[model samples]
Target: MRLLLVEDDEHVAAALLAVLKRHGFTAGLARNGAEAIEKTQAGGFDVVLLDLGLPDADGFEVYGQIRRLSRIPVIMVTARADVRSRIHGLNLGADDYVVKPYDTGELLARIHAVSRRAALDQASSDGPASGGTGGAPAPGGQVLTAGPVTVELSTRRVLVDGARVELTRKEFDLLALLAQRPGVVFRREQIISDVWRTSWEGTGRTLEVHVASLRSKLRRPELVETVRGVGYRLAVPPAL
Candidate 1:
C-alpha cells in the first residue's frame, strides 16, 4: 500500500519508514503540515499517517485542510493522547488515532483499519457503479476460474472440484477478488478495502479468519497462498 508519513521528527520518521518499507509498503515522508498537505494534493496515496506536532501549523489544521481536499483516510499519529485531542481529531474526520510510543504492530493495524474504512466508504458512495462489491467484480456478472476453484460471480457460488462450496458474503468477496487476478499479491489493505469495503487495520484479523474459513470450506488449503510479510495471492494448481 502507498502511505504518506507526516512527521517532523527525522529519527522517528526514518525508523518508521524503514520498518514500513520492509513490510512491503511504499511510503513517503513529509516533515511538516505544509509538506503533508502538498504531497497529498499530488495524489496517489492510500493513507496518511499524520503527526499532530508540526512546526508550521497545527496537525489539526493540516488534517482539516486535507479533509477539505480529499476523502483519503488519515490516521492521527501523535503524542497528544488527551481525551479532548482524540475527540477533536475524530470530530474533524480523522479515521483513526494512535498515541505515540505505541507498539509498531498496533500502529500498522490502525493504518490498515482507517484505509479499509475509507475504501468501503468510497465503494458505497459509488453505489454499484464500480461493478463490484467494495470494488470487487459484480455478482452474477462473470465466472472466475482458477485451477479447481470456480467462482460464479452472479450467483456468489463457489465450486471446488465440481462440488459447491458455500461461503459467507465476505468469504466470497475475498476469494473472488483474489481469483480475479490469480497469482498476483493483493496487499492486505487492498483486500480489506475491496472485500470488506473498509480499509480498517483491525480488519486484518477478520480477514485472516475469513481466509481460514474459505480454505476449510473449499478443502484446498493451497488455493490461497500467503505471501509472507506482504499479503495474499491465488495459487492455481498446474493442470495435471
Candidate 2:
C-alpha cells in the first residue's frame, strides 16, 4: 500500500522509508504538516503516518483537516505515548495509533489492516446495497420516515417535521443504519465497525458523538434511544 510518512526527523523518516521499500511498499515523505496536507490533497497515497510535532502545524490539526478533506485513512506514528494523547488522536478519527519505537512488523501490519478496511468501506458505499446494513437501495428514491423525521437515501437528505435537517456524512450514515431497523438495538461495536469500518477500540466515543449529533440535527432528542450499555435504536419503530 502507498503511505505518506509525515515526520520532520530526517533520520527517522529515512530509516522508515528504507524499511518500507524493503517491504515492497511505496512511501513519500513530508517534513511538515503543510507538505503532508498538500501531498494528501494531491491524492494517490493510501495511508498516512503522522508525527505530532510538525513545524508549520500541529499533527492533530493536520489530521483533522485531512479527514475533512478526504476519506483517506491516517495512522498516528508519534512519540506521544500518553494515554490521553492516544485517546485524543483516536477520538479525532485516526485509523490507528503507533508509538515511537514500535515494532516494524506491527507497523506494517497496521498499515495493511487499515488499507483493507478502507477498501471494504469504499466497496460497500459503491455497491448495490447502501450504508452499513448492506441492504439494496430502495427503488424509485426510497425514503424512511420515523415520527417527525425523514431520510432520503438516494439524495442523502433529511427532513424533520416538514423542515429540512442537514447532516454530516457520518451522521447521515449512522442515522440510516438505525433507520434500517428502527427499534432494533444496534450494538456500539457494530455501529463503529459499520460506520467507521475500523476495529480500533478508541472509536466508541466517536460513535456516541455521532449518535448525539444525529439526535440534535434531527431535532428530536428522543428519536434515538440509548439501550443502556448495549447500543441505540430508533425511538419510533419502522413502518416501511
Candidate 3:
C-alpha cells in the first residue's frame, strides 16, 4: 500500500519508514501539516499516518482538510493518550488513533484494519443502494426512522426532528443497525461482529462510547434502550 507518514520528527519518521518498507509498503514522508495536506491533495497514498504535533498546523486541522478533499483513511499517531483527544480525533474523521510508545505490531494491525474498513466503505458506496450486507435492509424504504431521527441508508444521512445531524462513521453504523429493527434487542456480541467486525472482548468499550455519542448526537438518549445483560434496542416512539 502507498502510505503517507506525517511526522515532524525525522528520527521517528525514519524508523517508521524503515518498518513500513520492511513490511512491503510504499511510503512517503510529510514533515508538517501543510506538506501532508499538499501531498494528500496530490493524490497517491492509500492510508495516512498523521502525527497531531505538526509544525505548521495542528494535526486535527490537517485531518479536517484531508477529509474535505478525500475519503482516504487516516490514523492519528500522537502522544496524546487521553480519552478526550482520542474521541476528538475519531470525531474529526480519523479511522484510528495510535498513541505514542505504540507497539509496532499493533500499529501495523491498525493500519491494515483501517485500510480494510475504507475499502469496504468504497465498495459499498460504489455498489447497490442497499448498503453493506451487515444487517437487514431498511424494509420498503431507504430511510429508517425511530422517534424523531431519520436515517437514509443509501446516502448515509441522518436527520433528527427535521434538523440534519452529523454523526461519525461508527456512530451512524451503530444507529443504523439498531434502527433496522426498532424495539428488537440486539446482542452486544452481534453488534460488535456486525458493525466493528471484531469480537466483543476487546472492543466493548468502543461500542459503549459510540452508543453514548449516538445518543448525544440524536438528542434522544431513550430512543436506544439498554437491555441490561443482553445488549441494546431502538425504542420506536409512539406515533403522534
Q: Highest TM-score: give the candidate number.
A: 1
Question: Per-residue alpha-carbon lDDT of model 3 for 1-240, expressed as tens digits?
Answer: 789999999999999999988765789999998899899999988999999999889889889999999888999999998999999999887899999999886687677667756654664555466444343343335666777878776667787787878999888888887775578776787787768877668898999989998888888889888999978989888897
Shift in Å, residue 67, candidate 1 = 1.0
The lDDT ranking, best first, is 3, 1, 2
Q: What are the runs in model 2 whose C-alpha is more than 4 Å off?
A: 130-240
Off by over 4 Å in 3: 129-240
Put down candidate 1 lDDT per residue, 1-240, tens digits, no spaces: 799999999999999999898655789999998899999999989999999999999999999999889888999988887999899999988888899889886676676556655654554454444333442444332667888888766556688898878899989888877786577676787677666666556888998999899889888899989989778988998778
What does candidate 2's lDDT look like per residue over 84-193, in tens digits? Answer: 99999999999999998898866766776676567546544554553432333344425666666677666676777777788999998788777754666766766766
- TM, every model: 0.69, 0.54, 0.56
Cα displacement (Å) at residue 83, model 1: 0.6
TM-score of 1: 0.69
Which RMSD does model 3 reach against the true structure? 14.1
Clashes of each: 15, 0, 0
